[model samples]
Target: MGNAEIIAGIKIPDSQMAKAVTELVRDTETDLLYNHSRRVFLFGAITGERKRLKYDPELLYVGTMFHDMGLFDSYASETERFEVDGANTARNFLKSYDIPERDVDDVWDSIALHTTPGIPQHKRPTVALVTAGVEMDVLGIAYHDFSDKEREEVCACHPRGLRFKHAILSAFCYGTIRKPGSTFGNVKADVLERMDPTYKRENFTEIIMGSAWDS
Candidate 1:
């Protein structure tokens, strides 16, 4: 019901759904995650603009906001990948609002595959941009691509805080430590290895050799 605020030349979606999502995330997630999510949306929108890709702003906003929800205690699922838990949470929330199946699927894919590197880049605009935003923010994958002004503005609105790298790593560790097996075959394995000395990674070759097939 209010004017949409523009960050880095991208308008934050001000729809009812957007407001509801913002409120829910702000209440449920830590300040770190809530701010990170907002930055992700802003960065992703900036990337989409640079790439000249057509995407739904509202869907992208939802995907970015919910992408890390799985890392929270309330949404974390036992035995499921954090990414999948987040995706499922977003999917359910969207369905409750009667979002179209295709749009919901895009948002779900965006969240589920945000942690996976190679594929999301080839998907639809929203899915691809979600990963783009995350990589830019966390991994610094395209850090220089965004100008100093752009980065400063986005971070000014949602400051990464004094120890974002350490804080985010700790967040990842805390979120997945309870379900260590869920970190296999993904980047979170590195997180666990770095944070938990007792954690051992699952080797793909060993798994293959240990399979039931006798050939």
Candidate 2:
């Protein structure tokens, strides 16, 4: 494997494992998601560099690439949060390659917590960067941190299609719509709320009041 594609000064890892995961994701996910995952890796790596963080690029690459696996039908689980589905899928794949448990755990955490806000940023570098990359690409959080050239370069390579905002939201809705309970407290609840008018958000206050424990 050759380091053939470099975006924003970060070289795409060419390790055998890297190539394997890349091939898996590209084959399994739609172009919208495949390209988004690649952009996540590039943006994550760039952020890691800017922060002067000491991290393994290969591990981060794997994490970013697999972070959205749960959103696809092949990996989606009936009774789990989409994030957990993705984490478990990545865990299984890495364990197959006999990756060390510690590294495997990091990748698991990265995918599981990418949609979570506040917490991941405090975890390991790989974990934090996964969420950072997602936020940057999806919500445009910290959009100004990257230079115009960097943004253009990454998008030029991955090309966040003409209607990325709506398309991604649709993807999210499609993935989790069947398992609405899984979105109880997470951000996907918002996706369901927007896409499904019939979606009834689980109200925290109502749950507490309905609980058997009486004050």
Candidate 3:
């Protein structure tokens, strides 16, 4: 049987999967991975909000977090094809949520295609929204500074700062890509206007990236 089939056979309810996700996120000690997921959520949510995409913020948030849940799956360690395993695991877990077919597909596709570069570019607004979210997620993984254990420990206690860091990190990571027809051009502007209401984009980028630990 496929991993997805096995996961589907598990009796965990949607509510319980949600609880499991929440607890996993809460206890995750890997700051880098946690922050990367947070940025993907913020980026996806903001893009969806600005474009009026039909995706529910709560759904996007959960999917992004659990999109990578399979990394911890036994499959990731056993098989070389972790992305496929991750996608299957996500689809199975989401099915427990009774999530719509379309949204489930979206989340699955995002997880599946995130690491593979050079796929044919998509042009749909919703596709673009997800693509940008996933791209920013990769950028965060490739570039973010997660070395300041003290800051991460401190920010963990300050949920507000953590939230701000999440948003800012998303902006810093994916804010520069002007993908064809991308709405990100205005995204940074919106976040800055909404988050700071005063600073220019250059200042925002400089300040946030400067303060983030690079090593």
The superposed Cα distance between candidate 2 and the true structure at residue 197, in angstroms, equals: 1.3
TM-scores of all predicted structures? 0.97, 0.97, 0.48
So what's the TM-score on candidate 3? Answer: 0.48
Clashing pairs in 2: none
Q: Candidate 3: which stretches are off by over 4 Å?
A: 1-19, 27-29, 73-77, 117-128, 140-215
What lDDT does each candidate get? 0.95, 0.92, 0.49
Tens-place lDDT digits, model 1, residues 101-120: 99999999999999998999
lDDT of 2 at 157: 90
lDDT of 2: 0.92
Best by the TM-score measure: 1
- Cα lDDT of model 3 by residue, 59-128, tens digit: 5556566554544434343433344455676677677676778877776676656545455136333334
In order of TM-score, best first, we have 1, 2, 3
RMSD of candidates 1 onward, in order: 1.1, 1.2, 15.8
lDDT of 2 by residue, 11-76 (tens): 899878999999999999999999999999889889999999998999999999999899888999
- Greater-lDDT candidate between 1 and 3: 1
